[model samples]
Target: MNDSARAKPLPTPETQHYWDGAAAGELRLQRCQACSKAYFPPRPFCPACGSRGVRVFAASGKATLYSYIINHRAAPGFTAPYAIAVVQLAEGPRLMTNIIDCPQTPEALVLDMALEVAFQKLDDTITLPVFRPAGA
Candidate 1:
């Protein structure tokens, strides 16, 4: 990880499991046991049905390119001309992430392109899940 890396997310009690899973190289999500709806940005209660009975499970780590912007200005912990993107996960949730291991250009980043998770170990306790073209 670079010294200028962006600020890391602080893990709270409700969201710690997700961070732990990321550190362990797994993308974890909370599913409402009652509603069976999978969600992201972990919360204490299910957004779909107001169920407190939620279970944390590993996600398939598959997604498709939904949206993006090629940033030309440098930002904290990142270089200029990088792609900031949103991926629609196979589990029916969308996540904001950086698209990695590919050219940061419009022609290279096609809409609905297949992606697979790649963990970038930022530190000892935090590993961010980024994506790259599947099998690329």
Candidate 2:
């Protein structure tokens, strides 16, 4: 595909740090200092208590399959039969990401399966967070 046809990333001030971390192969998240809660989709304030003193931390990139669906219909920039998954990270956040490094069939995906983070760089400024089966 040409550069113009490739997918573009949407980065806002609140999400810039997270995208930057992904470019460096790190999973970054927002943690509420007061409640000790970790969350994804970086925000300006803590969702638990509306506190603005949240901190950014690098995650271990370990997660478990929370839920998912096998999409058979093709979209503008995606192929058919891809797995769209919601992964529950070990740090206490659920991230929406794609399941890669395996077949997109029902037999290949199981609930609560262990997964590890992987990245797909689409452009100079965007890196997508994907997941794969975890090792022992």
Q: lDDT values of the candidates?
A: 0.92, 0.89
Query: Which residue pairs in candidate 1 collide?
Result: 4-77, 5-77
For candidate 2, the lDDT comes to 0.89
Q: Evaluate residue 62 in candidate 2 and report its C-alpha lDDT on the 0 to 100 scale.
A: 94
| Local accuracy of candidate 2 as per-residue lDDT tens digits, 1-136 | 2345656779999999999999999999989988888887799899889888899999999999999999887665677888889999999899899988888888989989999999999888899889999983
Let me know the TM-score candidate 2 reaches against the reference structure: 0.93
Misplaced by over 4 Å in model 2 are 1-7
By summed lDDT, which 10 consecutive residues of candidate 1 come out lowest? 1-10
TM-score of each: 0.95, 0.93
